[model samples]
Target: MKPASKSLWKKSVSGRVMVSILVSATLLGTTAACATKSGTDDAAVGVTDDVIRLGLLSDLTGPFKAPAEQQNLGIQLYWDQKNADGGACGRQVELVTRDHGYDPQRAIALAGELNDSVLAYQISVGSPTSMAIRAELEENEIMAIAMSWSPDLGESPSLVVPGTYFGAEMVDALDYLIEEGRVAAGDKVGHIYFQGDFGEPALEGLTYAGEQNDIAVEAVQIDPSITDLTAQVAELRKKGVSAIFLNAAPPQLASVAGLSEAQGLDVPIVASMGGYAPQLLDTNIAATLEERVLVVGSVTAYGADEPAAVAVRDLYAKSGSKVPPSQMVVLGYAISAVMDAAMEKACADSELSRDSLWKVFHGDFQIDTQGATVPLDYSTPGVSPSSQVIVLRPDKSVPGGLEVVEKDYAGPTVAKFLDR
Candidate 1:
């Protein structure tokens, strides 16, 4: 496969380089037949008489390592149970994991190495890394469920996004603040964000919603490498904004929250799901987070009464894991359930080829995660699978150190944003 075009990558918006993919008769033709054959003469590459292999691209040693490791555990937990229960389509599930350490170039190389050997990538961890490898997956006609979400990924049918993108999440979060009377029309809202894929989309959402609500949006773009957010928080404080929105990593969040409290910014702070971690509750800023920060995400929180949440919790206990609870684990298990359903569809069709599996998502196949998230459908290109979001606040007593403030929220701004 060709290396992603450097010129295109340079021009890509907010680090999101997208392929203008058109999935049609030609895409589903001989390209799929060219896949490596195995198992009863019709199985695709990565499928054997006794195993079906899926790839894992994660950031095990980088900034997001904590949550990434938990997600990997969740992925493994799902397969372990499936393999124990006689597996999917009568074959045990196998994972081919590669740790990219949050590096984009490393992710591209790792994805190339696994392109021809796995049925699909079960998880691709970070926004930048996922963006980096997307073109290669399209070139190889492989499918992947990217844990990162960007508007760019929506354009490709080959990459499945489990829920709405960061933009939608941010939009709903702002609306949640408005509905809860934290902010109102004509108020000024401050936003602190990273410079690339993850933060840009969220900033866009906040800007759009601000316009609709007649609120002035004050945005500060920060480099991810910067851990001290005292200046940013002080700047926003000087602006006298009513609320603050954040899109960044956990450490950055710690800095912002701590500094905001020390400076008496005294405003409600909301963060994108990426901006938090369960471990943050053990830090000096723990009380501040619980008192002020709200996190927006699509999946149910850990220890929720939802059935899938309970199942994953049981699995974690059975495995004797010392890792603290995380919502990423539930997401890992949910995406695996989606992958299993697609493969099962292909098996029932009597043609377990790459094309058959890919077609399931493009057809009427719907993914239900039993309350892990809203039901998902991937048939429409450039569209989010679900707009529903769950808002949570930090609570040390909670199993995940977070509890839901609102569930299944689809505020008008977000609903309209997704509609467009």
Candidate 2:
């Protein structure tokens, strides 16, 4: 794996570079004098002489349970590997996890319970859950790595999103379709999405892309609780949409593909990161997905021949996990890697507090996932690390049932949408 370039800490943001340098120099000078420091223990929320506690709030028994479980496993593997390497700095990292079940109220309670116990939250699973706890986290100066990529959360002080927002992903997908001749200007493009925050950003992106490209976009909203999408597919077919963008969960994507095929609507289908789950390949609609579905995301595919992907696979194997790796697993590993990088920086500065973490996070430091994820630059608030995306098609031959069709595919629509 490639080490994070030292130049990043000195190049991206001048203010941050100075801060980190000054802090590191000052801390190093005081290390011997404060070696036996004890009264200041209360100043560091989750830091001890030999441990640094982190929190993970995830959904373990809710709609997103499958991905949540995989994410948790990936995070565990990352920390395990870190601890095996003598941990970050001299402290052994500990992750305290809680199951919020995708409920905002439950997340609020959990945050209250963990507010003073962790240095930061390594992962917050849902958009709503993160929103519910945003105030408390900010008040307590806790930095949380949000799992949701909602654009609104992009600018939040207490939360950091490791990937591109759903809106940008949609824009990139549409741009790809238009560029590849899958769809054209003035054609009717249908967007089938869940009705809430989870799907709204995608619809915004599709609409924005449509306006820019002169493509007619139509939205078909689906209730999150509903599974069958035969009627929705039939409606889009009746509209004569030449291409469809689905912003729903994995099972929903499977249903749309299956029902669309059943209805003889064989138009090209593009989906957000949430749309392609590996388990869908084991379902009756696997063939349909393999034929029609294309997924877009900010991370590299699980089977990519990158050092990070190789490391993730080896870690899973070492843990004796019988289940195959998937996008969710890769996501988990990537998030952990990013957070661990920041944590390491904080430790090196001997400032493992929330403020120090935020400083390191927004510094010139760019997370080098070694090709596991889109390289992230948190220096700019509300801007994504990389607008470029990896486009993948469902293929049964791959371990994750998806293969890269294009790596870091950039198109006209991304700049246009982000600029807006």
lDDT of 1 by residue, 1-420 (tens): 022234332322232311122212111111111122344554378877778889999988988788888888878877788777767777778999999998999999998889878988999987778888877776666788888767677666567888878888888888889999999998999998988768888888889889888999999999988999888888999999999999988888899889988998888989888788988999998999999999888787887877778888888889998766689888887787777777766666655667667666656555667777656666455577777788889899989888888878988888777766
Candidate 2 least-lDDT 10 residues: 25-34
lDDT of each: 0.78, 0.78
* Candidate 2 structure quality by residue, lDDT tens digits, 313-382: 8788889985568877778877877777677666566556776776777666565577766666666655
**Deviation in angstroms for 8 in model 2?**
25
Top candidate (TM-score): 2
For each candidate, what TM-score against the reference?
0.89, 0.90
Question: Candidate 1's error at 123, in angstroms?
Answer: 0.8
TM-score of 1: 0.89
Which residue pairs in candidate 2 have backbone atoms (N, alpha carbon, C) closer than 3 angstroms, thus clashing?
none
